[model samples]
Target: MAYPDNLLSRGESVVLSKRPHWKMLVLPIIFFIVIVGGGFTLAAVLRNWEYHTIAWIVIGVLGLLLLIWLVVVPFLRWRTEHFVITNYHVFFRSGILHRREHQIPLGHIQNMETSVSFWGRLLGFGTLIVESAADQPLEFENVASLPKVQSVLNQLIMDDKQAHRGGPQQGGYPTGPTPAQG
Candidate 1:
């Protein structure tokens, strides 16, 4: 999904935008398959028994509830979750029903790290932990292409610092008149 540019400062732009890794969909996909398969299996078994009408009704209701919780909810949660890194801020927004958004400015960031477990290394995705001065650390979990994200964030932080300093701009252009003539 495209980010709203109105929220950004004039010169600022998104450096990286991503959703959680496909690994996150593993459990939801499994649950979806199980729910569908179980529904079919229950229907077949009910057909074998002539007096299963009432029992089938009860099972169907329970199955639907389980499907909503295990399959549908997880899918929606996964779809809504987002992690974004812009020149000025790191944004994390997530939730299925009531959403929550957290932002950490690059200037406020005290420390950052990239982490990967054995399984995460195997999957080629990792997490980014960002700690700022005023607030608690924010974890961007299950980030796809984590190394690239880390590199881009570092570059953005440097560029942001340079932008605020106004000493030199891109392509080695000075913000003020050079003293070479004087």
Candidate 2:
């Protein structure tokens, strides 16, 4: 999904936007299938019973509840969570009803690393840990293409620092006139 441009500052542009990897939904999908399949099976088994209709109703209600709690909620959380990289900052936003957003300026980021387990490496997703100035490291889990993300973030941070120091920048223009030139 596209990150909302309205949240960006003027002149800022999005570099990357992604949600958690599809692996995050595996359990939810499994639960969904089980709930649907079990509900149908139970309904079929009760078809000849005296209270079959009532049993089916109960099964339907219980299945719906289980699906909503185990599948729908997780799906919504995964859908709403966003990991975005911009020219100026990195953003993480999550929550369904009440939103929570956190941003770290590229210039403020001091360190970054990627952690990939054997399964993660085989699946092409891992965690990205971002450490900003004087702040706790923020871990973005199940990031797809983690190595690429880390590489891009490193480049952005370098470029941000260069621009702020009035040095050579990505677009071959200094951010502003240096005091020495003025």
Instruction: Please name the candidate that would achieve the greatest TM-score relative to the true structure.
Output: 2
Per-residue accuracy of model 1 over 1-182 as CA lDDT, tens digit each:
56667777888788888889998888978987887788779878887687788777877898889989987888788789988899789998898779899988888888998889999898889988899999877788899988888888888887777777764665477666679955
Model 1 lDDT at residue 84: 85
- Quick one: best lDDT, which candidate? 2
RMSD of each: 3.1, 4.6
Off by over 4 Å in 2: 169-182
lDDT of 2 at 96: 97
Instruction: Give TM-scores for every candidate, taking all chains together and pairing residue i with residue i.
Output: 0.86, 0.90
What tens digits encode model 2's per-residue C-alpha lDDT throughout 1-182? Answer: 67899999999999999999999999999999899999999899889999998999999999999999999999999999999999999999999999999899998888888899999999999999889897899999999999889888888988888888767755576667788998
Error of 2 at 55 (Å): 0.5
Which 10-residue window of candidate 2 scores lowest in summed lDDT? 166-175
lDDT score for residue 164 of model 2: 86
